[model samples]
Structure formats: structure tokens, C-alpha cells
Target: MTRRTLMAAGSMGLALVAAPRALARRADSHRERVEDLIARMTLQEKAGQLTLFNDPFRWRPGNVNPGDFDTDQEKTAQQIRDGHVGALFNGIGAEQARYAQRLALEESRLGIPMLFAADIIHGLRTTFPVPLGEAASWDLDLAERTARAAAAEGGASGIHQTYAPMVDVARDQRWGRVVEGAGEDVLLNKLFAAARTRGFQGDDLADPLSLLATPKHFAAYGAAEAGLDYNTTDMSEQTLRGVHLPPFQSAFEAGALCTMSAFNDLNGVPTSGNHWLLTEVLRDEWGFTGFVVSDYTSERELIAHGFAEDDRDAARIALTAGVDMSMQSGIYLAHIPDLVESGDVAMEVLDRAVRRVLMTKAALGLFDNPYRGADPEVERRVVGSPAHRDLAREAGRKSVVLLKNENKLLPLPKAGKRIALIGPFGADRSNVFGPWSIFADREMGVTFEEGFRAALTDASLLTVVKGSDVEAPLDGGIEAAVAAARDADVVVLAVGESHNMSAEAQSRVNIVLPAPQQALAEAVAAVGKPVVVLLKTGRALELSGAVKDAGAIMVTWFLGSEEGAAAADVIFGDHAPIGRLPISFSHYSGQQPYYYSRKATGRPELPEESEYKARFRETSNTALYPFGHGLGYAPVSYGEIVLGSETLPWDGELTASVSVTNTGDRPVDEVVQLYVRDRVASLTQPERLLKAFQRVTLAPGETVEAAFTLTRQDLLFIGRDMAPTVEPGWFDLWLAPNAQGGPHTQFRLVR
Candidate 1:
């Protein structure tokens, strides 16, 4: 039925929610009892419960199924009729989901309900800031709220499960899809992952507004070789569990429903087919019982990893290794039965997998009410709704990173200003949309022109110049752009990679801008006018050349549809930009994975290194813009920290506070970070580890004390034997915005 017809029909979910106390309890109470029904089902029926095939009706193919399935339409339909297919993916719109539900309930022998899952990563219909961009906000509460908004919108659009809050700690800029994760900060990753999971799976699972949270690519896929997407990840075991594993652990603790395995191999083993990662680590130790689902045909891709010989072998290995769901990769359809009959895979294993899947559906209130998501009216009213867009705009505002403001060049004056907005990235809607945005309304994206238009009530004096192409050089357009830049009072050049430049499979050799584009930027800077460079892309680009002598610089990843307005607002003093860096920006591309926290290499590189030291010839190990680096319209001066407890036992606690003062003419936000360094511990240890952080807003010249409390667990690390423990020794504490800064105090540790 159409949205209008459904709304007019009216006797739907609201009816159940608004019913009388006794009758409402009786009808809706059945949702909580869905688990009992699944418990009584036979093994064959239980396997059917976990089997979610694609519903070709409304959820049309974005691409063909992962190689294991028969790509032909007739074969796919026949499988659904075979009564083995359970849930489906990418089916949007209520009518389509309802139709799929009808097929499962009416066509299948068991009349089971199909669980609908989709990649509602950031925003479902109304696109929000990319996860990495959102990480710049460093607001866990906001992250959770954004997840709720996404879940509501996705659920309203007939999406039951959202593959979201991709909590990978991305350090490499070459991986284009690192846009989906928080970059290289364990504390940042944990906070956002926990927030998103809680938001996706809200207080009540039975609420139709909630969707199951699938925090994914279950391991350190972000550290892929040379930062290449879908490439093998090799890291020390200590780095893996301590740095990369925290986000997954936090997401799991927040009650995530499912976890999707990564595309890359762990060590030499493909994650989808690795029993140790799935069973020994995730389930047995970490206690992740919700379920493990393979990424889009990841099992079939194991052959490409050189671990499996064929699709069948890949399926056998993955399923036996603890993968419960075969997403898009149709390997199970062709081979699971044979493997079961051959006694290579036990029926009990299948039963346990099916049990987990059914448990999730039951938790979602899907089994009792097959028509859970069939509300066409709610979909129309709430799809791309105003409230959701406003949230997107809020997140956009928070995602902006104001990097440099020479002599306070920012908070650009709105009145009496000849504003020249130059560069190819300023007007492109697609680049701002970021990747994995399946449903992002590119047409609706607000461009920099829109931002400028909205900020300048009367846009009579604003000049525009497409200075250079993002993917290529603007060989012919530079002359006109230079003239405009020279004529204007201030120039804002928006430049970065094109829309498809920095995501999955989008890794680069240099991790720098195209040489021609760099030359174009130099020609513009030659105009000798104050230039403000605003970067728009997924990963960090080496900006030493562009930044060589720019008046001001702003680092903004694809800032969603509302970013234009937010950027303009910050530029013109309506809002002081407070966003910080989520990933480290290196001085050059060679110092990649150049995070603030890392084990000091035995041969550490310095300006003048000793013969016994490890160092680099081409470059230094310093990043261009350090993590937690962002400039506001105002500057905040930090003072010395005071610690309450200087010596503490293993189980003792300590309280610390650092005073900060906004010593500028405008309001701003400051992020105070607390870190601890083990004076002497294992042979391999990072110089320091981030323990706590806080973001406090201050008015012009205002001051505040940021406080942090620490427990012994905060000092613990995964030992050489892989045991989480705290070593007894002296420790140094550093309280700073960036890692390049020195420590606040040195304290002794009691045994």
C-alpha cells in the first residue's frame, strides 16, 4: 500500500501501542515470548531461522551475490521456495519488506519471518557525517544519539538490522573506506562504538524504532599492509589486543547483536575462516555470543587469501570456524548440505549457529509479528524527515576541524568582506557524500556555495573560482581563479580528492595530492592574498605544500549534506569551530600510521640520531597535525596539573586536575587529554597510553579545570604472555592536547 493509503488505514502499530492496559499487555507481550517459540523448533526449522536470503522484490540488487550463490534470478527465487531462506539484506521500503515477509510466511513450509538487514552505517536515508568525520566530534553522547536517529530512520525504511558504527582504528590513509571507522585512537574508538551500539539497540529491543547493531570487520583489518584495503594485516600480538581490540570489546559490552568479520586476513589466516579469532578469542574469552556473520562473501574471498582452494572449502572452513551467517556469499546454499551429509560439519554446530540467529530475531520482536516493519505511512513521514536532517546538520557542525588561524584569521567577517571561495571541492556534492553512503541524497547535499549563501544574507560581493580539479589539475582555470583570489579580501580554497578517491581499494602510492593539483595551489598562493585552505576527503593527505604558507587551513572530511552550512557558520563567527583530529596527519606520506601513541622503536629517528639508533633519512617521525589537534577562533592556554595521589598501590586510585584558560577574543572548545607512561615495563611498550579525555566549552577568555580520575585498570596492559596486568614501577603522567607536548608530573607506583 502507498504511504497515504497506509496512513489513512491507520489501524497499525499505533493501535497496539495505544490499546487498553490489559488488551495491550496481552497482544504486545507476545513479543517478549518469541524466544520460547524458537526453543521448541526442530533443527531443520532452526537452520531455516538463520537463513536470510535476499528478497529481490523491493531490495533490488546493488550487485550480484557473492560468488557462492547462483546469480540467475530463477535460481534465487527457487531457493526461497525451498523453505531454507530466512532473512534478507538491502530491502528498503515497507511494502517491499512486507512482500518479502509474505513470501517467507506464505510460500515457505514453516511460515517463518525474514530478518531484514542493511548497511545503514552512518545514516540510512538522511546521510550524516562519515564515521571518521563524526569521530572528530569526540562526543560519545552525540554519537549514541546519531545512531538512534539512524536506527529510527533505517527501521522506518524497513531496515531491521544495521551494519554500523564500524569501530575500526584506522591509521592508514591509503584505505579509502577508512571513512567508515574512527582513526587510530583506542579511547575514541571505544566511546563511539559503545555509543552507537547503545543507540542502535536502545533501552527497549522490542521498540520498532530500534535496529540490531552489528559492529563489524571483527579484528584489526585497519592495519592492512601499507594501509591498503582488503590487504593482509600484520601487527604484533600486543598491538592487536591492546590498541585494535578495545573498540570491538566496548561494542560487545554495549550489547551488539552481531559482528561482521573483516575483508582482510589476520596474520596469514583469513578472518572469516579463522577459528581462533571467532571462537577462541571472540566467543570463549571476549564472551561474544550474539552471533558472527561474514562480510559480503568474505568466506568465498578466502580463496583469494590463498587459504581455501575453492568456494566449497572456503564455506566449510568458515562455517566450522564459527561464522553463523553467510551474508551475500551464497556458499552455504551450494555446499553446506553436502558438508553436513559428509559428516565434516556436525548438525549440532549448525544448530548453535541457528540458535544465535533466532535469538536475535526473537529479541527484535520479528517472529511474533511478521509484519513488524510493514508501515508505509511511517516510512513516508519520517523518511528524510526535517528532525533527522537537523541532527545531520548538528553532527556536521561537530565534525569540522579548524586547523590553523594565523593571527586569528578565521571567524571570517560576514559584513564588509569580499569573500572569494575557490577550489573544485567547494561545489561538488558527491565528494561531500563520502563512500558507503548507499542512500545518501547527493542531490540534497549543501555545497559551499549554499553555506556561503546562507551565511551572507545578501550575496552580492562573493566571488567564486574553480581553482583546480580535485582528481586532476585545472590547467586552464588558474588564471581566472588567481585574479579572483587577488581581488578578494580573503580566499577560501576548498581542495581534496574526488568523491571516489579515498575509500576501499582507493589506496595510494604517495598518499599526497596529485602533483599537478599541488602546482595549481602554488599558483593561487602566488597571488599573495590571505588564503584559507579547506580539505574535503576521507583520509588525510600530506598538506606540507598546501600548508607551506597558508593564512588558515581547515581539515574537513566529507561533511555530509549539512556540512556547507556548518562550515560557513564556523567561518563567519556564528559558531567557533571546536572539532579535533581523529587521525594523524603526517608531515609527509612516508610517516604513515603516524599516531601519537606508539612503542619507541629501538632505533628511534631523531634530527641527529646516534649510530645505534633507528631513524629515517627521507623524513622525521612527526605528524603535520597531531591527534587532538584543532584550532578554534580563540586560543586556550593550558596550565600545570595537580595530582591528589603521587604514590598508589596496584588497587589504588588517583585524582588529577589541569586548569585551562581561553586567552582569546572569541569562544572555543578545548580537549584536555590524560595519558600515562610506564617508566619500565615490557621490552615493547608505547611511550604513553591515553587514559581519559574531556571536551569543555569556554566563552571568550574563560577558564575551567578539566578533571580525570584513574583506576589501576587504566594502567594495565596485555602482558608479554597476553595477560592483562599492571606492572609495579615509577610512572609519568602527561596531560596535553597532543602527544608532542611534555608531561605534567612524574609519580611512583607501589607494589
Candidate 2:
């Protein structure tokens, strides 16, 4: 397709299937019906429709955790009966969801169907790798399939919407929620955002197996200051629009049904009360028609943010700012009516919010079948099934990134080599399924010992040692670990953060290996056996000490249920490690907001120049391992990048091609990355920006020509006046394996 056609398609929702005339007519009828229902709703009912709360009572057997439910059961039931409750979240299973839906439909006077929502971030029951690990795969299709599986399982369990596909372009590793997002690159984040949305919603929302996808923490929550969660974000308008907003745009265009507002304030206005971000940018400019829900208690937290005086003020601000629903915050139900009655908040704003909420319910077919996804038999059949586990295993294998492999220590011989598996995660099963896997059964995950035994013909060839606790002192266990390594032909040191270390509210000031694990690595390395460091982490960490000096290092970021099996596959050469780093690994923890795509400075530190200018006094100002860097067993070589022409008209396309050859005995998949830099522009640009990339699998001695077509639209950036446009400029381009540096060529755009 032409560039114009592609842009137009994107704007018009390319992810959606073209509906038949009959379906379109039916949708119009549904809209008319929704409007009629809205007209019938009282102000109290309307306020209730914008209120979503957790199920107050725990109905599941043997577990009685009183979540965000109302303490007074009679009052809660009365509220449901009066049509004063819109939806229920954190409801456990099909039975609980059915009970809640029954109360809304059968007990309520208006009989409005309630939407069920949950934080199904990665998986429901059949867990896959955490989202950051999935992004590391760099496989859009795999990411989509993983989402599809999660959606199916979640749907079977009676979930109508998932607060997922967190498209926040996370640049800081210290940000605790990095595990919940795609890494720092905008294009990759955009692609995965769309893919996950399509996977969750499928071809039609009416499909029972599909659920609404929520791309969240709406604005720039990922760029929180000092890598702190919910911290203030201060940046230029250009940076906000250029770096953070594209993923949300992509997700919305890909048919996301809803969005969750961020907790942090952009500039001085909290996202829950930022009308410019929600209405101006999201609705007016991007044409997003979906409803926006506040993050958990975010609307009420606006008071804490000092943006609002009280709950009543918070409700008015958030409602006016374009939030349709309050998640777990009863401020909307308590205060919106008073605000609307006093004319402090417009009646039309309340009506618009209710309309959006009901529209989503209508689209999900909840109005027609309130219990669409609440099927116990389907839940039992689908959740954690054999087929789902296979997919999890496949995803885990693809997510493994080989950061270093000196002397070809990896793809270890499976038969004769005696392996010593040592670390906190050596025989541990629970920590493998990382954070946000709330519903996953820990016992179901494959442990490291289990995986090694499955890969080897004889289980006797492996000696397992606990070594030391993840963060605890070495004590005397390091001696035992060293002795085991001495007896074995090779040592595989499994080390990194525990499952609770890298998720929400789990931020770390020091992003390095735990002292005990580092000490164990040193002791194991002292034994003289080749050491392979298997890192199971959620975010990037500073590779230092003996862990960095190990013969091989593979980052297996919380690979979910099949982590052990997946690691075994790569270690045994069953699968090549093709995954690339979605985020850059900083050399030290002090580089809080480091990424590859920073704007060029006038006095930039160049390798050829002296150290006096813009250089760090103690450390090198570069990522330890740059973004898109990964290694496989087979070696691949890249020829120089070739441009179709040195200069082109502003509206025309420039074709860039490069030949990549696999010069090893084994076939391998190579991720050919294309980067571009605007040499001069009205506004300064990143030194290099990833524009296009292709993953190609090649056999021994096989060379493939990878080409990309770039148009003026691809080079568009936010200018001085905060308008996006492509300016006439000389553009330097690169075709390489990673984002650090490679062969370069230049092209120009002319008016």
C-alpha cells in the first residue's frame, strides 16, 4: 500500500474487520436503544453507571479474602437492587461473576447489565511470560497469540474487560512497573499495543471468547521522576507527544474498548484531572470514542496530589477531564450527583460519560447476554489446558535473550556434560511466574531442576544446589555450591530478582544483582568450571562482578509456567536465542532515564573526541548492552546499507535495502533493524530512531536482501509550535543488528 493509504487506514481503524451492511444496521439500532436507555436513567442511576467497585463478598470456597467490597452486605445488595451499582471487579470465578450479574439484571429495577473487569495483565490461569519478556521476543505474531490465549481463558472465567496491554514506553529500569509494559522503543510499543488489542477484542466484541483490551496509565506515567511510581512527570510538550502518546493512539486505532487514566500528573495537572490530555489530545485530536476509567483510586488520589480539595472536587475535576468511570473509588457515586445538581459539573458531561460506558456494554453484547463469558464448563476446559501450556512454552523460548556467549559455552552438550545447577531459583517453582500473574497456580510452573531433567537423557548428570537465598547473606552455602561446581563439568548459575522485586510498588534504588548471588557466582567461577549465568529478572539490571564475567549470560525474564523448560531448550540448542533487548541495559544504576533515542546535544561526547566534553567522570555514557542486541549460536553478517537514491521529493518514498548472510553451520533468525536520524530539523531529533525492522530466518551461507520503504510521513516529528510535520532535511540511516551503531548512509528530502 502507498504511504498515504497506509496512514489513512491506520486512522480509520485498520485492526477492525469490515462489517457487513446488516451488522452495521444492527449497530445503529443498538446505538438508538442505548440512547433510549440513557434517556430513561435517573441522575442517581447515571452516577451509578459510572461507578465500578470490587465484589464485596467472597464466594469462592476455602478462601475468604474480603477485597474492595462494601462492608455492609445489605446496603450493597440494596444498591445493586436500586440500579446504583454499575460493575463488579476482582470477582474470582464464573460462579461469582454470575451471581453479581444476576443481581444487576434480575434484582435491579432498570436491569442494566454490569461489565466485569480484572487486571489480566499477562495471563488468567494458563500463564505466559510477563509483558516485558513477551516484548523481548520481538515477534508481533507471538505477542498476539499470547494475548488471544489469555483472552480466551479470561473470557471463559467471566471477565468482560482486562486492564492490560500496558503500552507505556518505559525507559527507566528502576520503574517498578516496567514488567507490565513494552520496553522503551516507540515503534515496537505501538506494534505490540495494536497486536494485543486485536488479540483481546478479536474480530468482534460479541464473540464470547473475546474481551475488551484496556491500554493504560493513559498519558506519561512511565516517565515518572527518579524512576518512582506515580511520581510527577515534567517534560516538553514535544517529548510528551513524540515519546509517550503514540502507543495509546495505536491501541485506540486498533479498537481498544477502554483506557485507564494515569495516577501521575503531567506538568502540574494530574492525569485524572488533565482535560487537555484526555479530551483535547485523546478525544478531539485522535478521535478516540472509548470510555476512560481511572486507575485504582486515582480519582480520589487527586486530592493527595493537591489538584483537588476533596472527594467532591476530585469527582468534578475527573468527570470534567473526561473520565467516565471511577475504579474502586466511590467518589463518583457519592459526589457526582451533588456536583451535577449544583451545576458545578455540566449535566452534558455526565450524560456523555454514561453514554460511553453503556456503548461499551452494548458492543460487548452484555446487554443481550449478561452472562456471556460466565461459563464454568468452558472455564474448566480452557484454563491451563495442555494446548495453552504448549503456547506458554513456545513464548518462553522465544523470549530468552543471550546477552553474552563467549567461547560458544551455550547450547551445551546434553549427553556427557555433568551440569551443576545452583542458585535461589535452582529448584524453586513459585517465583517463575512473575508479577501480575494473580490467577496462575505456582505449582503448575516448571522448575529449573524439572526442565534440566527433561532436557537430559539421564537425570543423574545434574547436581542441584541451593547455594544461597536471593538477597540473603552467603553464610556457609557458598562452599557447598562451589564443591558441587567442582564435581560437575559445568556450572549454570541461576540468579536474579525474586518475583516480588520488579513489579508495581516494587521499585529498587539499586538495580544490581543481590550480594549473595554475586558472591555465589564468584565462588562458583573460582572452581574453574565454565559458568553460564541464567538471569530470571523482570527489568534490566547492571551486569557486574562475577556474574558479568561468566562464560554465558541469558536473560530469561520471568518466563511464566514454562520458564524452566524454555531455558533448558536454549541451553541444549533445541531453540536458538533470537530475542532482542526491548530496553537498554545501563552500565550503572545511576543512569535512571537512559535510552538509545535521546536528542543530540551540541557538545555531544564522541568516541573520537576528547573526554572533557559531556562525558561522565567515572563511567562511560553508554548502555552496557544497547537495545536490539541479542546473540544466537549461529553467526550472521550484514552488508552495507544501500539507498535507492540519495535525494527524493518530500512526498515520495525512499527504498533502503541491505543484504544479511548467515555464515554459520546452523540456521538462525536474525532481526534486521533499520534506524534513521534527521541530521538537521526545525527541532532537535534523537541521534537515532528505529523506523522499521524485519526478522528473517536463514540457513547456512544463505543471504537475504531486507528492504524498507520510508516516506516523508515516517520522518514526521513534533515541531516548535507543537505541530507534527516533516521538514526538509538530510537523513542519516543505518541497517544493522542492533541500535548501538553500524554502517551508515545518508538521504535527503526535498520540497
CA lDDT, every prediction? 0.76, 0.85
Model 2 pairs whose backbones collide: 56-69
lDDT of 1: 0.76
TM-score per candidate? 0.92, 0.95
RMSD of each: 7.5, 2.8
Off by over 4 Å in 1: 1-54, 59-77, 605-612
Ten residues in a row with the worst lDDT in model 1? 10-19
* Residue 751 in model 2: lDDT: 93
Give the per-residue lDDT digits (tens) of candidate 2, residues 1-751.
2323323322212133332233234346579878888899988899999998776643322222224345566777788888887977765577667877888888887899988887788888778999999999988789889999999988888888999889999998999899988899888888889889889888777777888899998989999998898899999988888878878877876788689999899999999999999998788877677799999889999999998999999999999999999988789999988888999998899999999898778778887788987778988998888998999999999999999999888899889989999999989987889988878866789988999999998889999999999889656799899889989999999999998889887778999998888888888898889999999898999999789888999999999999899889988999899899999998999886889998768888877885666657767678999999999888899898888899867878788889999998888899888888989888888999888778889998999988877778777787777776777879899988899967789999999
